[model samples]
Target chain A: MSRKLLLWLPFALVFVLFAVFWLGLKNPDDRIIASNMVGKPLPEFSARAAMPDRPGVTSADFTDGKPRLLNVFASWCVPCVREVPVLLRMQQQGVEIVGVAVHDSSPALATFLAQNGNPYDRIGLDEGGRAQIEFGSSGVPETFVVDGKGRIVHQHIGVVTEQDVPQLLGMLGKAQ
Target chain B: MRRLAALALLIAAPLPAQAQDYAEVALPDPAQEAQASRLMDTIRCVVCQGQPISGSNADLAGDMRRIVRERIAAGDTPDEVRAWLISKYGDWVSFKPQVKPATLPLWLIPLVALVLGIWLVSRRLRRHH
Candidate 1:
């Protein structure tokens, strides 16, 4: 009876471990832990102008007494294209957006904006993608809410959906 | 045998280069390059969760490798680079998690489990004896 109980215990332990692993895998949201950039001043960066008609953006622009969204995007990132409608909605609602084009080639960006409608007021060309990394972004489609004082108030990882608009607006309010 | 040769050739070509991003650092310092390589192994590829930047081919991992090399070339010590990354991405980016209030339980729980496991086995052995 004791030997039987010991044998059962190993199986029970294995079953419990497998059950825990399966439970952990059920969560599909893959965003990493909250960004440490929140509440910190924006990292300094200067890039070539990606938008032909607009001045190139820089860290200093965030201090212009206007709360704005700084979006990191690229022609290669699919999720940035998906978030276009949400960005358009924000633009229509009077939100000023600064776009940073990672690994930018001006012609590709011009075509991308012409096809998707330009939502950016100031666009910077981060040709080496160094500025995006300085922003602590893992990939494109990452947005930062910057206050009038040049501090990063919030960070949104992955694609921003319609549902995320309300929280983004709320953060904008706080940025005010 | 031809299929086997093709398979081996496929493995021999381009695959290893993909595993190690060989974007030659223009800087003439081998020591900095070695330090950057070591530092890359200690940072997580944020988008790919469990894989370290050293072994991942994911785009973010490539970006991370570039950043590691650039910083090391720019004269930041490995500790400074680690601090900067941790400051931006939070503690989760480090392969070696720093000892902090939040991580104390994570370190202790494994030891606690091991002790409990040993205790259980010893109890079972005593019962058999």
Candidate 2:
């Protein structure tokens, strides 16, 4: 091969490798499957009240006889805000929804709830994120559907949507 | 000319160490800083492409670090803060994509590439022999 061709070959190989690496990395699906805690007992943890409208609501307040949906959220989380309408609709449909505000301040969370309208039956504040860790969450806006026995029957990661609720409800057997 | 070239090489050699030294010296709140650093390992710096913010020396990564620190200091929980970042930047900001339709390719492409690579290599070897 000519000297110029030989010099270009290494550069070409490097470019191909770079392209492959870029494509592989840019594709967002390359991730480990997070642990499926669905159909398993929900981990127990206590948190302070977070409801802006009702400051008295605590973790103890969530233990009613009905099935409950525990949603981990934060004021700063955009997806959590996106899913607010869905959760609000669920609340209207009489779903027992509990909110866990992970790693957020009372002021910011209060403002968020005030602006968005709170959809939770009771809200819990996980100030230090200890409670979130206990629940095996890596991030916020994760929803857990707890059965009457407090076992987690379903877990949904990322933002919840109107479309997702029907499937979630089906999993919980709350659907007709 | 040799002495001048030697000086240039020395200057280039210490550039990375100097940069590292700056980072080490500028350490802020150790606890929050460590958490921010850990977050960098897990979070893909969007502007820097595939590299984790922790591993990248990109300007975007530094900006992300600043953002992470700001959220943490403002009392956003780690998960909440991460989620916030992901939301603002898209799930692409996360080194590990949350399972979703848009991100299915991220999980499958690597395996597909691996299988194709192995198949091609095996076919080439077989033909060679």
Candidate 3:
């Protein structure tokens, strides 16, 4: 082989390999299309609630009585802020909305509620995110529909819209 | 070939030690820890720009970790924190950009270019043959 060709061969091989690897990697932003977890029992995990002028409350305190919507949110998350109005609307329609403040502070949460208007019946403070992982949440603005039996019926990732309400209600069997 | 072999060895040697260190950390609250880990996976490291803080070892990632802990501690709420970050850094701070008119091209350009490349190559091959 020509000397030029011999020197160029290794570079060409490396380039091709790099290109293949780069192309093969999946897109980072691809939607996480979850398998059916509907009709199945929810994961057993306890979460604390953000109490009024107090430390906070726990999942043990609010898991009983009625089926509820557990919304995992944070002040820093944009999508979560976008979904707040939708959640407020749900709360207006008598949807039992419980908040899980993941990795946030009490005063900041108090301020957030003061500014945004609190829609949650009970808010769980998962400051360290210990409770969040058990629920299999990868990020904030995750909503879970928990049945009266304390089983999670549905999980919504990203900003929830008004259009999602009927579907959420349908899962809860509250939709007309 | 020799250089490549040496590079591979260098890369492989550190990974086991790092993995061992990760495993050795005693996670008192596994659930909360997992949640923090998951959140890190979605949030882009400010300094790295392209990679998530979960995958990044940059000093900025550590700052982001502290920020995450603070937000969770302060009860700012996850959604609010994401909004704050986006407001501060723009949508690029998010590992996943929302699909919109502006971002559609980012998704479609690759496929369009692939098709064009194939067509051009086939045309050239036909002419050569």
Per-model chain A TM:
0.81, 0.75, 0.74
DockQ-sorted candidate list, best first:
1, 2, 3
Off by over 4 Å in 2: A1-33, A52-64, A174-176, B1-129
Worst lDDT run of 10 residues, candidate 3 chain A, spans A29-38
Model 1: residues with Cα > 4 Å off, grouped in runs: A1-33, B1-28, B109-129
> In candidate 2, how many Å is residue A162 off?
1.5
- TM-score for all predictions? 0.76, 0.49, 0.50
Point out the higher-scoring one by DockQ: 2 or 3: 2
Q: State in Å the error of residue B108, model 2.
A: 24
Tens-place lDDT per residue, model 3, A101-173, is 8768777887887777788877767755555544655567888887877666778877889889899988767
Worst-scoring 10-residue span by lDDT in model 1 chain B: B19-28
Where is model 1 chain A poorest over a 10-residue stretch in terms of lDDT? A27-36
True contacts kept of each: 0.69, 0.00, 0.00
What digit string (tens of lDDT, one per residue) describes model 1 on residues A86-131? 8998999999988998876888988888888888998999855668
Chain B TM-score against the true chain B, each candidate: 0.60, 0.52, 0.50
Q: After superposition, how far is residue B125 of candidate 1 from its true place, in Å?
A: 10
- Rank order by TM-score, top first? 1, 3, 2
- Winner on lDDT (2 vs 3): 2
How far residue A87's Cα lies from its native spot in candidate 2, in Å, is 1.3
* Predicted complex 2: CAPRI docking category: incorrect
